[model samples]
Target: MSIREKIVKEYEFLKPEMIKTIGELITFPSVLDEEAVETPFGKNIDLCLDKALEKCKELGFKVFKDSKGYYGYAEIGTGEEMIAVLGHLDVVPAGDIAKWESDPFKMEQRDGKLYGRGTQDDKGPTVIALYAIKSIMNIGLKLNKRVRVIFGTDEENLWRCINRYMELEEKPSMGFTPDSKFPMIYAEKGLLQFNAIGKGESVVLSGGGAYNAVPDKFQYKSKDLKSLEEKLIANGTKYEIDGDTITVFGKSVHAAVGEEGINAIKMLMLALKETGVATPSLDFISDYVGNDPYAEKIFGVLEDEASGKLKFNLGKVEINSEKSLLGIDIRIPVTISKEEIVTKIKNIIKQYGFEYEERDFLRSLYVPLDHTLIKTLRKVYEEETEFDSTPLSSGGATYARSMENCVAFGAVFPDGKKTEHQPNENLAIRDMDRAFIIYAKAIYELAK
Candidate 1:
């Protein structure tokens, strides 16, 4: 049999193991908890890293875990040069338990799909990449470069996991992360996350979790919120009330595709505005940035052919008697300068008595379409899926930019299910099976 056929045969037998391993990872609820001193990410995240490395050892790959508990890696093949597969194990908080069909931490298989918190985001893909390497090992493929699969614990928030990896670990010659879609991502938008803080004493409000996910749930309480609740229903939103506390529901997707999901913070503010509520943050949002994901209302049209349009997302919001704050996530198109965008934002937001303070920034990434990393992955994608190998530009930040010559490969198909940050997050079984084959062959070609 050919190398591809042998790898496929080995993986077919490993499918059950693959499911178990991915599910085992999903059970960790490895959300970052900076307050936990047991490890850099959190107790659960550190334990999750330990479990993942244990799995690597069981798979017979030489494994190493960072003493600081920020990252880990499993390696095979042998050479001075190394090709790497980097993915994160950390997940965003499971916002509301009632919204989930099953426990978000426990993987559920039904209707040929596995549902869980981290299934489609990074963990599932990370495990698939691991098994792909396992399959390659079963066939004893000759390698000219060492193949390393690095696991990070902070892709959802700050990429401190990757930052620590670069500081201590060996850099790979070239690699791909299976954290994004198939066909391959050649360019990624720059990310700008910040808080817009100003003075206000109008109303009390707060909501949201991660800086990169659209806020899908918000909780607030009031003595008389009946009018606002009616407005919420009139707007066709899902909500719940008990006593004086109310929880408004919105759709959550990664901020890269921010427009696809609803921002719950915006929903509450819009309803509150109708009830004559006033706050510095709420008033600014109503006047300048209602519902439009591009922030075109304020920034005009920031678009480029390489990376599509700029995306604006209100991931968080808070207002009180003392102050008001807006936690914003912006994806700037690849061609746009971050400085230019920030300057315009400062000038405009200052008009509302708010100061923009940057929390994090990731410069855009681009690998030429003709580059070997892109071409080889494109060839493999077309050959395996029979899908067109059109290179894609992404707004989601991946670890591809962390290394010198790395690009995001696939775990999600071009027309596949995308439930990354939302409730009922899941990955189709068939899609993952296909991804297994693609990953094995891609690793073989890249390493050999």
Candidate 2:
């Protein structure tokens, strides 16, 4: 039988197993955290590792858990050649369940789609890849290589899971991550997170967290909020008033793709200018919040890169007797230098005599399109689906960059909508079965 036929047949046998695995992963709220809290980031990660280890052992693949709790594998063959498949189980925090069609944690299947948080961003594709390995093994295919799938538990946070795994494992020859879109991805933009504080009148606000994530809610208090509202309206800005509490409506989006939407910080700045708190110029706040000269000279730059508009969120606000701290959050392009960006921001603050400090800085990551693994996967995508999709770039981050020779492959299709990190996230059931066959073929090709 043709490889495609064999793959489709194998996927039919693998459907039940795939569904059960995804359901279990979504049940755990594995968002990232630094502090060792009871339900901290990887609270149920060990449990996931246990499940993966059990299955890997059953599939005739040797499993290894690192000292730091990350897991690895050894799917043995000959010639000292190796192939890697990367995937993550940890998911982003589910926000505003009221916006969801169903529980974000519970896996729901409707109209050929499975709805849940990790169902698309990663867990779905990850399971498909594992079963791909199983299908290849079940067929007793002999090849000249070994394929190993690595499950990371902290990809949404610091990527410590894969970092720890590398400390105990050898790098693979080539690999693909089944987490992104199809046709394939050839380039991925870098990411950076920064904070800026100024010494204007202070406001009282709190409850924003995760620099890479959009804050669910935040509120600020200013003695002159009435004037603030007037200034905002005068400046062609938008906002909401609640008694003495001024709530600026900041658009929320995943940090990787934040540039595509309106930022909360800019709205607050406009509101401040309308109220005579700061200059209406983007530079006024950009100087305080951005890292380098880019903010100072961004007015013209906005026209060129406006397709990927940069943005910030006014996650939290607070006013006090000392000074109001505008908890401004920012996401910028990857090509910018971190120190230069910070220096420009510091310089802007010095001019206003406002003190500013950065709270978190996450580096951006990217890989080239000509990469062998990327080429191989792209070829597979074209051959299998007859779709000539090229490897594309994205603002979102993934565990693919955590290791070498890895590019994100698909559970998400191009015509497919982006529900990742958004409410009512889901994966089409037909897409799930199709992904299994694709993954199985990719694994067979990589393993051989």
Best by lDDT: 1
lDDT of 2 by residue, 117-208 (tens): 88887777787788788888777778788777888877776777777777778888878788777866544444445445554444333545
Q: What is the Cα-based lDDT of residue 320 in candidate 1?
A: 80
Candidate 2 TM-score, C-alpha based:
0.74
Residue 398, candidate 1: how far off, in angstroms? 3.4
Clashing pairs in 1: none
Per-model lDDT: 0.88, 0.65
RMSD per model, one decimal: 6.2, 5.3
Clashes of 2: 19
TM-score per candidate, chains pooled = 0.71, 0.74
Residues 1-448, model 1: lDDT tens digits: 9888898789889989999999999999899887987688788998888999999999998999888778999998789999999998999999989999999999999999999999998999999999999988888888899999999898988788899899988999889988887877779999899999998666888778688998889888999989998999999888999899999999999998888998888888888887887666767888888879898978899998889999999888777878878899999988889999999899888988999999998888888777888888888888898788888887766778787678888788877978899999999998998899888888888888
lDDT of 2: 0.65
